[model samples]
Target: MTTAYLYVLHGRRGKIPESNLELLAGFIADEGQLGRIAFLEGDEQTLEDGIRDLQGRPGVDHLAIVPVLLYSATHIRWDIPERSAKVLDPSITVTVTEPLAGTAAVERYLERTLGAAVTAFPGRRVLLIAHGTPHFPEPFEELKELASRVGRTIGVEVVPTNHVGHPTIEETLADEHGPFIVERLFLTDGRLAAKMKARVQAIESGDVFLPTLEDDPVIINAIRERLAEAGV
Candidate 1:
């Protein structure tokens, strides 16, 4: 049976930034493999439709779905599996890989990103902003540990905050004095990055906002590793 790969995302406003996902898909297709993008929310194409379309392809039977998410939130914990189960054909073999949050590649990416921020603005506290889930605390806690680990590795202090839960970005910024380096932990550059940038700008604390992790080679390598693990 012919195998195809699908990268699932929580697209913003029916759109996503031009990032490594596009590049990976193109490269996969060039290598004679199938790669497709699917979204769980927004007005963009849905995951179910994407699966159906891929299954309809001639001789395609195995589908490897990689959730292009940084954290194991509700999307990866429940939504994707539940939705994919509903739409996949009986004869199709499907495998869903783990999210990118806890992966070594991601940790390296965070460490590298935070390292650069610390170098650029020495003595400034680093604030890591993540889009957390309100229903569960595990994801946010994971982020906290992640930040702490990265901080220890880089010999800097990294404060973790969420846009959805306690110690919100606004509250953290308001509580802290002096300039800070704000790093948004998003999978791609989209509305969330824009919104966070705007928020930091409005604070006027001279907080330096790091650029979004778009087309980062580290991230692309992380995805490649996931695909390899899944035997894609």
Candidate 2:
């Protein structure tokens, strides 16, 4: 079945964030599979457009809406699916992949990031930050669990928190052992990531920021694997 890869990004005013565009282009490059990719920055391309385009293609039966987000939060359970459900037809099968960090793929990414940060800041702790919801506290718990698993894998201590969750970065940085390494569990350098990074840096000048998942070979490979799992 012919399938299209729909990239759902956290963009504003329908404009592709600078670094995100570069990362997306890179994701469609040599090593990454799913050559036919369509970027949807916020509402850049509505579900109607995607469904129409796919329906126009002969023999097309599947559409994979793969969110490049790092966590399985509200966006995964609500926003992305709600939007896609609007235009999906019974004739076509739709598969939306799980958020990035929850999958096994993230294990390697987290381990690699922790390993690198530890190498640079030998005695520092890891602060794994993600955008979490307040009322729906499950995601925060997921982040905490993920952090613990990653910390165990790499033999380090990880402190997980949502931007608006308890134990704010300031608290974590201040209360936790000094010289904390701020690791971003994000997909791109969007406003969310940038603002949070700036906030963390303002709090602690010496903190280190590990690379966001954006367009990394590992991330792209992980996405590619997810797309293939949609039975494309």
Candidate 3:
């Protein structure tokens, strides 16, 4: 019997969103021969504990760590592997796949999310608000490129804005028209999510539409496809 373990890696937040985790579990059950489903938190000790638990499971043949992250940052590339090695047996075949970045599915998801806002208004400005990384600028740039592509494809004016790093909401909202839509590009509803909604609401001139993470089917499908590709 082939026993495959689907391990989802959490980020600095120390916990994965229940919705995202549910989506991942559903994908694994639909695709691979799942032996055991395990959730690993984002701490050093918790990750080790999760790996050890998996290693101790009987009849386990293959172990795969799928990170539910947006980019291939230091944590996904280095920290996850280093921590997993401490508990994994050397004989076991282990594979760590890339995070959800540069995938056509993800691009499609972003396009659809922004496309909806564009369709609402014929010639108005639409902004794709994303959680930006200060140290690494690749994700922000990638989002910007995606927004530009979507705008050109749909023949609408759209701009990608970041909240944490440069080109902030203030900068993006400057010189913009009334009735703006701030689409939150996130996988979970955490502190950042709340803060984003509040900031948009505080804008006096325009109306903001807050779409929940569950509303975007494209994102859900993209995550499913990413897991399927990893042989989950």
Top of the candidates by TM-score: 1
Candidate 3 C-alpha lDDT tens digits along 61-134: 56776665666656676678776777788766876656664567767765676677677755566667777766
Write down the lDDT that model 2 would get.
Answer: 0.71
Candidate 2 structure quality by residue, lDDT tens digits, 121-195? 787888888876665777788888889999988778898866776666776667665457877777775678888
**Model 1 agreement with the true structure over 1-232: per-residue lDDT tens digits:** 6888788877766565456666667656766777688888866668898899998898998999988888887999899989899999999999898877777888898888889888877898888888887888888889989989999998988888887777677787787655778888876777778887777677756788777666666666777777778777
CA RMSD of all predictions: 2.3, 2.9, 3.5
Candidate 3: which stretches are off by over 4 Å?
1-3, 7-16, 35-46, 59-61, 174-178, 210-212, 215-220, 227-232
User: What is candidate 3's TM-score against the reference?
Assistant: 0.78
Worst ten in a row by lDDT for model 1 = 12-21
User: For model 1, how big is the CA root-mean-square deviation?
Assistant: 2.3
Query: Scored by CA lDDT, what does every candidate get?
Result: 0.80, 0.71, 0.64
User: Candidate 2, clashing residue pairs?
Assistant: none
Q: Which residue runs does candidate 2 get wrong by more than 4 Å?
A: 20-43, 228-230
- By lDDT, the better pick of 1 and 3 is 1
Cα-based RMSD of candidate 3: 3.5
lDDT score at residue 166, model 3, on the 0-100 scale: 76
Model 2 poorest ten-residue lDDT run: 31-40
| Rank list by lDDT | 1, 2, 3
